[model samples]
Target chain A: MSFITGKNLSCIRGMKYVYGKVDFTVDAGEILVVVGKNGCGKTSLLKTIAGFLKPSSGQITISCADDLQSLDIIHYIGTSSSLKKQLTVRENLTFWSKMLDSDADNIDKAIKSFGLDEMSNSQISYLSSGQIKRCSLARLLLAERKIWILDEPETALDNDSLNRFIDIVTNHVKNNGIAIIASHRPDIWPDNKKLLEIG
Target chain B: MGAFLAILMRDLRSDLRNRAQFVMIPVFYILAVILFPLGIGPETGTLSLIAPGILVVSSLFASLLALEKLFSSDISDGSFESIILCPVPISVIMAGKITAHWILTGLPLALITPFLAIMLGLSFEIALFSSLIILLITIILSLIGAMIASLVINTGKGSVLLALLSFPLFIPVLIFAAGAIDLAIIGGIGNSIAPILFLCSLTSIALPVVPIICAAIIKWQVR
Candidate 1:
């Protein structure tokens, strides 16, 4: 199974500490919820794991069951939806699938799985913020990565959309996928997860 | 190859849908080129003599209008982060973006150069010949713009900063491209080969190199 572990991990930006001296581990089929006060480096820590930022000290390593490179098996969804507003839902998803070199079949499946069939042809700019968030989340299914790094994924999501998100993450973990989520609402997360608190 | 085409097509599709923005580049190019003749007087000899430089400089300014959006939009929308983190090589991804920028701004501008060239008292043959040089110079401008755009992505005044940074880098391209066209107009078509070959060599070097540099700068910007 795949696992990620951080030892005495610290993140510093602009000569100031965001988080420091922390250790955590999560394995396949597990979720790690990173919680903290605003500006506490929760996002920085997630970015560090995603290889977007270099940690000021310590190390975070990913060991997957397969021989794939760590970056190849990891997906990071940040606070911004990353969906192009000018394009329709299907267009955005299709672009991601192609960029990731994923199977073309997943395009329609992702649209259907996210309940975006009716809105598939609607431009993202016309959709509600919640709808836009759903379109971005559909991107997760476009690739077959082992690790998912999500930062504030629940923002702008409605109750129904949040439930859908939970289901997707649950299904993902059930299939031996690892999810590392950074969120303000730890209570809304699935029961099967570990918590890493930051300040 | 799939990832590369995907990024390129995605950008092209987006631009096509935004017709106003898509049309503005060439419209601006045309307007700017037309202004030179009006201000310089309709003297054919003077206009013909300076047509190459006028076309090159005006197109450069027109390109600046679209450069800010090249990387800053992706950064602001957070699409840039996802784009870089994708499975494809960063260079390939950036190459797609640079190509897309050229298509949206450069290609269209080149297509309309004949009309603009005629307005400046250039013959159809010389206009057609100069369009080729214009196309090459635009490609180089797009490459240089991509790098400068990525570098200034997070700055408060990205467009202003982009203009300042890209202006200096664009000087060499302007010289060769305009010089080539000048030779074609003043001398014979065959006489322009030296500068045309120089422009080609510059494009050859930039085609492969700029994307790598852009990739590194983008990673650094996000980091």
Candidate 2:
């Protein structure tokens, strides 16, 4: 397992200073929930950490004995659903799995586990918001990554869907994977999770 | 190779299923070409004189229409971020996306150019030759335009900025391609072949270089 550390992390987006001189660390087998009010740069913090946004001044170092770079082991999901609307749910899963270098059999497993088998062939545009959220999160199961960065993943999910979402993240963390979730509701997080509140 | 094919296949499926975006490229090229003869008198000599240049420029602008969405839609929908997180090199993924854009707009423009050329009063041999040049020219323009689009995708007025940034880079390739097609119109293998080879060499170099630069810019800007 690697130690993911951000030293003196300062991020600026456009003219606004998102965060200044912050530091945090996460080892394998843990979940860190980022909680804050609207417009508090929670998403920006996760994005900067995901390599989507460059920090104004800081360094994120992923340390391990292996020669692998940090990006090789991260799966970053943003606020919006990443599925293509025109393609069927199954097609979106298949394509992303293929892109992520996962095998075909796993696609079916993810579909079945996420309870999307019945609507697998339906186009994403036709699915409801909760269904779309499920389809989006189902993609996580298709690939294996050491670091998972999810931004507001509970957007439109119903209570049942939210439980399934929590279960999935808990299982991943239990298996020695690291997850950093940015959401407004930290109370919903599973037990034994770390909390980082920012404004 | 797997990552490249995965992006290509995914885009191919998306473009095939919802075709209004790509269909506009060839349709716009045809519409723009038709306006030239209508706007000018239908005189054979004058129309023939302008036909090759007309085809190249119309296709260039048509390619611009497609390039804006080449990165913006993915960027908005969060798929672009997922792509970055993949283990595969972002450059190879970008190359695949650019190639898919070419297949949709460039390849179709190439296949349709001969008809537009003949309609503009070019001869059978001349139209056939110019179509091949237009095909290569379209591919080259898409590569250049895609690079610019990647840079300006998140800006306030990105489409306008993309055009402003990419058009200057496009002018040189446009001049060479139009010149080659006009040389073909002048009817000689010796003079025309050299320019055609030069144009091909340009496309070949751009094939690798443009996507790699676009990928690097995209990665840097994400931060």
Candidate 3:
């Protein structure tokens, strides 16, 4: 059974439209790449599936490890860096860790895994573009939710960091977690990952 | 219960870390009160005449200054999305943020009003009474301001819109707060306490209801 399923989903923002009756499903223990040009509703689709944006019309169901309960089964990381600039890297992680109801012990591990130990005390505003993105990715990693909806997670990262990000995604999928990444970069795509392209 | 405490602590920590904004509210309050002496001559009678109104109005602006930052940053950075996704209800989350805002802005301004009143030539009894009344009214105004702030989060020039939207709701509190001080100055503590108590009751009712309304508006805006 699919971890996330959406039927006839559509979203409109003012005069500029993003979605049009899009249908997709993501299964557990699998990676799904959503490839599309700029302004192709890729981000909106991720948001709708993650329960951030309500669909103008259609049905979305997310199944978690425990059970199915409407659409409350996913953690969404949007294109914007969600880290509070005024907060240190550690503080930002702690805030989200608590919000996601995750184990506090894993926060340190997640920071180290993201290569953010040295910058842990640094406020997010002082971090470089890549560091800020890492902070946001760390929050996503720290969340206990099973389904991940990441929008353009590859933007503003160096080649090495991109490889590290892909590794994180692979590990998450290997652990029976599902991820739907909206990106245009082909190099990050794994061999077994399914591609859903939107024009 | 845990989620509420977590949000409140997080917000308070953020507010303290950004000390400049927190410090500016009281500084503005003091400065605004000081200006009355400059404009109307520093006579004890004249300063006492306007002290209560000045105190309440200054407290109102101080609370309003921090209202926009309450939810806008969270909304923009996607932290608000994470919050809404929590298993705890949205009303609880909204209440947490509003309560934190009151403690940081409204509570401080309320505490300092007695010192401010002395400077403005109020008698000791009148000063203490005015401070207590302002504290009660400020909490209510802060909650109402928060509700309006959440409603106008997506609007153009949200802070200005919030002030305009909430100012009318604040008029009654202003009237009662100032009236109570006026009564205290004339040795009518008994008369003043009733109005102040009534204002506090109004605040208690608004505390729970306003956040629920604000949460609904936020949900609608997100949709």
Candidate 4:
């Protein structure tokens, strides 16, 4: 019973309109992929929806079953990974899990879900970009958020890592979690996911 | 409460891991305090006379030194956005952060300033009293620093802008702290209470309000 609806949503960044009058809807147990050309406002739209950027003129509505603030239920991932290079993979993940302020049990589950068993002890600075991406993605599973607004989550991910990620999202969706992903790789995404294209 | 504790621990741990970043502030404070005596001649009378004002002013500058980095690293690394997304209010998170910052810079400076006061020819008793005064001043300055740090975190000219914004704002703390220390140096402990109590009032007001205002400014500017 969780859903996000946008009516007449328009986004402006520094006097330039990224998108205008775009409408979309996403519901529980669904994956909404935003596809668009470069600089055409895919990231802008996601940021606006995630509350990072305020909409210039529009209304983005959220309806949730548990009566929580829409922002509290969302996890936004931008292009830059929030991983600290000085800390080990486990350290970084543990820090994020603590910040998410959820059950500590999910910490172990997130580590396993990201397939980070071997590299858990390695410092993030030493890990490959793909491994780092996986660590960042693990944060989503660690915190139980209803909506995940991700910006280009596929960058630097390998095929195996991508599969693991897809499996994690699939499991999340099965549990009524929502994911709003902006990616250019349609081939990597599941075939049945909904698409929202911005010009 | 959970977010606040988590942030406080994280900040303390992060600072502990990178100890040099914080160590430099106190070192600079000592060095700055030592320089005044040499530049103006080491006459005990002159040194003791200016000690209260110089120490207070120098401490104010020391607080400004690190304010720029308070949120810049988190912002550049994208950790701040995560902090902002925490379920608790942003001001609470800032309270934790500002507390951690005070522990590192202001607390240490207060402890060491008594020793610095000795260089000014002040007696050990007044030095201890002056340290107490410094503790209060630093707390108020830390709160003001936290608010101004949020204001300038995103701008390019951060340190200069911080100095510009904070120098005028900190005038009252500097005046009261110097007044308290000067009174202690001249008229003994009893005479300094008025300014010290005034500082306490300022801190009491800033303790609750500054963080909320900082959070609001952060929310408005972060986008």
| Worst ten in a row by lDDT for model 4 chain B | B79-88
Error of 2 at B118 (Å): 1.3
**Residue pairs in steric clash, candidate 2?**
A52-B222, A53-B223, A54-B223
- What order do you get sorting by DockQ, best first? 1, 2, 3, 4
lDDT of 3 by residue, B49-150 (tens): 888888888888777888888889878877777666666678878888888988888888878888999999887777788788878877898788888888
Error of 3 at A157 (Å): 1.6
The number of the candidate with the highest DockQ is 1
What number of backbone clashes does candidate 4 have, counting pairs of residues 3 or more apart or in separate chains?
A: 0
Interface RMSD for every prediction, one decimal? 1.4, 1.5, 1.9, 1.9
Q: For model 3, which pairs clash? A: none
What tens-digit string does per-residue lDDT give for candidate 2 at A27-134?
899888988888878888888777677668987767752432346688888888878888899999988898788889889988887889999999998999889988
Candidate 1, residues A31-136: lDDT per residue as tens digits? 9999999999999998888888888889777774232222677888988988888999999998999888899899999898888999999999899988888889
Decide which is better by lDDT, 2 or 3.
2
Task: Give one digit per residue, the lDDT tens place, for model 2 in B1-223.
Answer: 9889988888888887787886878899999999999999899899999997899899889888888888876877888778777768888989889888889878999999989999989998888888888888988888889889888987879878988998899998888888988887776545688778888898889988988899898876665
* TM-score between predicted and true chain B, model 4: 0.96
The digit string of per-residue lDDT tens for model 3 on A6-34 reads 78888887876787878888788888898
CAPRI grade, predicted model 1: medium
Candidate 1 has which clashing residue pairs, if any?
none
